[model samples]
Target chain A: MILSDLVERFGHHPLGIGQEIGRMVTTPGLDNPPLNITEKELTRGLRYVAVEAPSGIRGRMGVLGPLVEQAEAAIVVKNADYAFGCSGCARANIQLIYMLRRKKIPTLEIEYPKTREEAKVMVKRVVDFLRGLGGTNG
Target chain B: MARIAQISCGTEWSGIQDLLEKAANMVGAELFFPEVDLESIDKAVEEVGVNAQSPNLRLMTARAKAVVDGAPAEAVLLLTCFRCAEGVITKHAIRRYLQEKTKIPLVMYSFTEKPKLGELLIRLEALVTLAEKKALLARERQEGITLGIDSGSSTTKAVVMMDNEIIGTGWTPTTTVLDSAEKVKREALEQAKLNGRDIEGIGVTGYGRFLLKEKMSVDLVQEELTVVSKGTAFLANRQRGEAMVIDIGGLDNKVMTLLNGVPDNFTMGGVCAGSSGRFLELAAARLGVDVPTLGKLALRGDPERVKMDSYCAIFGIQDLVSGLASGVSKEDVAAAACRSVARQVFETQLQEIDLRQPIIEVGGTSLVDGLVKEMGEILNADIVVPRFPQFGGAVGAALLVSGVV
Candidate 1:
């Protein structure tokens, strides 16, 4: 919530997968029935994955690729347990992180909070990272 | 206020609120996060079946119990993370369970720690729009003088309808969204020999629907998913029973299955424009012929003669260049491009659809006779082309807005 407030304050929209999937599931008359995603959106997703990837990658990419496209900057959490964040399709997750790196956008990699003390440090790091993006769009 | 039931594992554990307040406030929706005790989690795990030994997954299903137990939820968001294998499998299970178990609208999202706020606002806005404008989606008939404007990626289209029959249609290449909309709207009105004063209702749709609102008097603003199917059905005169509708437009393609003019399933977009009418336009530019001429020449050649089966527009064009350099006939090259687009749409979109008989093909590219023929041949089905296919979105918007007006 603090991060969201900060992102909003910084004049940048936060690009998240949840909202993209929500758009997909709610989008009327999409080709991906049972999920509300369009085939064209799926094709956009398909462009991200190599042809030789596993079958389920299409659906995941279809959700993630749009968010990545909207991102001006990214904040990736490092050293978080598998339990602390979204670990959707493992293959897609790794590739998406790699994609963020390759994008060469302003990125801040913070260690996940483990303790009360570590949590404070993480917040300070986040504040600094966001401040560093001053005068720059996220 | 609209109420959303959130079914999730580890949302709080991820240390984000899912921007709960922000999303809810944006949509004027009330968000609910149900809690399950350890006892309830244990009992629920049996029915949930597969959990990655993650209590979070178990708790997630337990949380879903509220909806099944008859809680008032206007929508449901099934959330998991991107990396949780067990959670993904479990999320799918919960999805199948909820789908089979309930009729509530379900939205699935994978959240990361510190998710972006703008994206969530967009989702919430869609939910609000779906709820508020639902009347536009389920209208069964149209009456009176109504106008619809469709501002698309490549073209602007307008249709004037009177008493359920299309009186006039205006089409122009899209340049400025508002200007193009006004031009097409004026053209349509001119053709109908009716001034704007005769129109009782006006609706706008497509990529520029919202833009028109600031400049025009609009009664309905709708998404193409429901409106397009409604339009196609009305145009094809297939408003009852089961049918499939395909629209190959200047930018994307839309394929939908409907029962009684309501879409139960549909997809909008090809793998790329290579699989859409835009590719046909590009192919015509390359072949030094108009789109209609390309269609005529395509009819004269065998599709199997020149190999240009690329489904990506850039690569598809490269294939066209390669085929031409190799001394392939222009007629054969046109046929291959048409057939290639047809084949790509078939492989990428149609394969996943529950195809109904009497496939109705609409949109500008539907007029390209050879592409239509190839698609018909590829599917072994007769493709129905409604009169004035290009104004499908316009017609649909006009038809749907009539309900509200």
Candidate 2:
């Protein structure tokens, strides 16, 4: 399913339920549905050839490295709240983020809270972003 | 008469034979030993294949054909030693073969001491006469005087030439490039035994050249491309067309296209220190090898690079540390660093520039053997590193001063 569809179905809450699930589920070690991604698709998406980066900052920053390798295509993730909130991780992700932005990757950073308890509200935010709910935000 | 072939050694697909040949010609030596591989002798200084024949006489018989075909009697190979001085010579056993095979005398001249271009030319002139080639010396004819200055982000280089004869050259950090230019100009004048008033004109080029010229005066300021093309042509000392000029400075990188002594087009990278001079320096530090020796170590590695994901200097360093902790071969890691830098340069900056012909790489980074090899492998193009690649821009500026630009 398209990320937008998933975002609209559960992203309407301010608790960021949809955004948190997206992060946790997409993370390599985390348990999530949609584990059927193919080897070819993974190879196509492989930008970071070396998986030496530690899981935290390196993982998020490295996310773009592999994407850049594959056709230099744009990969948009909605995490506006995380964008402003992530502190030390910012340094690691800054260059990749800037490169993605400068390359005009159609990026949409959606805001979500850090704690899992805020899930309901975060879901609403994701839904709002996915549905093009606000004129100025889009 | 002694015949010598001068060649500059680096770890790469090809040796800087032309640079050495030019040096030999400068010293009035007519004979040169064809390059040889010294791989079997594991005890030999690591990767000393090209150096064995440079500044050393190879077997005379191997060069008999060249001698019969009008090559010089003594082949004096020139080399810039990473461990020692600018030039070092290792006499190869080929000298015996040369003496046995041909009637011509063979000799090698290694300059361990740093000598400016003017001093080098005078020594060459004297050596030519000493080799009893007065007639050849008279007919050799020196090229005109040309001056080139590259005001790089970190270093400033100046090369002077007169009638194809490199007269004098100088290099210093960009932080003090203006001062270095002034100091080197004076030094060149002193070495040439000519007053500053003797200079008919001067030309400046490079990223910081514009800013430098504002503080210091010059007769001309050609763009980086034109000066680089002219400098490469001068180093070739003959027809140099359809060549790529890669100038790696401390902060930025430039790739230029030369079509018959003129710059046709060019590309430049961002002013980031990540994939340029600073990157090499940082990697070398991380590896604990001196920057100059970094290339030779890298030449020892197999094909696969260290496989670091990020090209950024900071993350790359961290990755290098982690790789070393995991027992990755230092040489492989170094080679990988070179590959990473080369990939960025070609893919992002020189992507559109043609890589069909052998590329003549200039600038400070050109001195690195590993980067040269990795660049060739990645680009799948023949790469030629001139003997004094660092001075290409400076020499081009000097050429402009002589009206060649």
Candidate 3:
């Protein structure tokens, strides 16, 4: 929520599974749900995730991969636990963060806050990074 | 035999030709690759308005040229390797180019060096459906009394008709698939002043089609791909030419390219609801307005006044909330929401095909003036919304089931 607010505050779009839950609902006549993107998108995602990874990994990569591809910049909050949600999509999230870093877009990774002071510091870091994105005034 | 065009550069080196031929044999289609002079690839690429260093990508324009210029081929098969990112982009360019340039049935695949039959069979079978069913697909009129029911993901719709004229339509938000179907069927029949026995036949289609099939004792059970096109054509009075149908539904969205009302090439699904009608619904609830009111508000507002960039409905809502809290008028937020959905659909779904004119926009979302207006502005073409657009799947079922007699 903090990240979404900061990005929107800075007039930038946020890319994350939480931001894209609508992808979970399958389109009419689509062959597969959750993973049912256009065939072209499916092909694009095929190269990113290891074939041997869990389907949860593939499914996560399937929807989130394209967003990662188009992401001009990204923010990662590492050491997040199950409370982070989407029922154990953490593995794919890990892979995607690595991808964003590799893409060499301006990126910032902050540890999940463990205390109130840490939470304040985390918010400052996010705000500072977002301000650096050179964006439109939303 | 159906003549199929084999368009690719690396098929010989990949050792996948046998699998392609075998799959075509399984579907009884004869495969033929269209060839142009080796030196013409550069000129063809320029003519097609796409540039790529891959000779294979350049060569794609040649095949597109031959197929569009009245080649004898009845279907097109496009292949490229999965490992090449350039191949995928060029392949899509070719697909879109072919869609605009010709009406021939086209299916594309990104293959591994050694492809298996299982990977290619279903796609080849779709080509067979188009080839063998051309006569039935070309039918422009419904012939008998029939009831069609579409048990869709978000709603159930029923259409009652007699001899090419629609008598009634029924719709309700979906709960239990079987119950919704039964309710709509009952409503349509009553409106038509008929009993179940008065209707000659019943047809079913949609996401919940199969569950309602045996219980409803349906006569024709077809998928949405064929059914929706038939409905769009019948309603739009364009059943005998090249027509395009864009159905932006509650949960997902679809774009179908058709010739004489038969779907030749199409793509459906959404990676984000920001592209689907559900986003509008969410925006409506947030704005304290109904979906219809939201559309009117969007027309009155200016998209330029709002600073919103939404790729996902969930995040789009965040932007909506922030704007609302910041004293942005509901109208601007609504316009922004509509534009966001339209842009998302264009970037994700519309980019997959080069649209044909006289585009018919159907499904529940078609009712939204705002969404349709935004889409039209982006595509720079007027869209036609047929009467009872939400009943596309049901109307299609009703139209085809008439042939069962």
Question: Candidate 3 at A77: error in angstroms?
Answer: 47
Q: Which segments of model 1 are wrong by more than 4 Å?
A: A1-138, B1-71, B75-101, B105-136, B350-353, B377-380
lDDT of 3 by residue, A9-28 (tens): 89898776676655445345
Q: Please, what is the TM-score per model?
A: 0.63, 0.49, 0.62
> How would you encode candidate 2's per-residue C-alpha lDDT over B340-393 as one tens digit per residue?
788667545553344537578888888898988888876667788877788877
Query: What is the DockQ of the complex in model 1?
Result: 0.02
Candidate 2 matches the true fold with a TM-score of 0.49
Q: Provide interface RMSD per model, one decimal.
A: 11.5, 18.9, 12.1
Ranking by TM-score: 1, 3, 2
Candidate 2 Cα errors over 4 Å, as ranges: A1-138, B1-146, B238-240, B303-305
Q: What tens digits encode model 2's per-residue C-alpha lDDT throughout A1-138? A: 233345335433232323433554577853435532332223322232111122343344333344443423232333545434232343334434434544553345544456776656655645554456432333
Q: What is the lDDT of residue B155 in candidate 2?
A: 80
Better of 2 and 3 by TM-score: 3
Q: lDDT by residue for model 1 over B102-153, one digit each (tens)?
A: 7555555566796666445434544454445555565767899999988888
Question: What order do candidates take by lDDT, descending?
Answer: 3, 1, 2
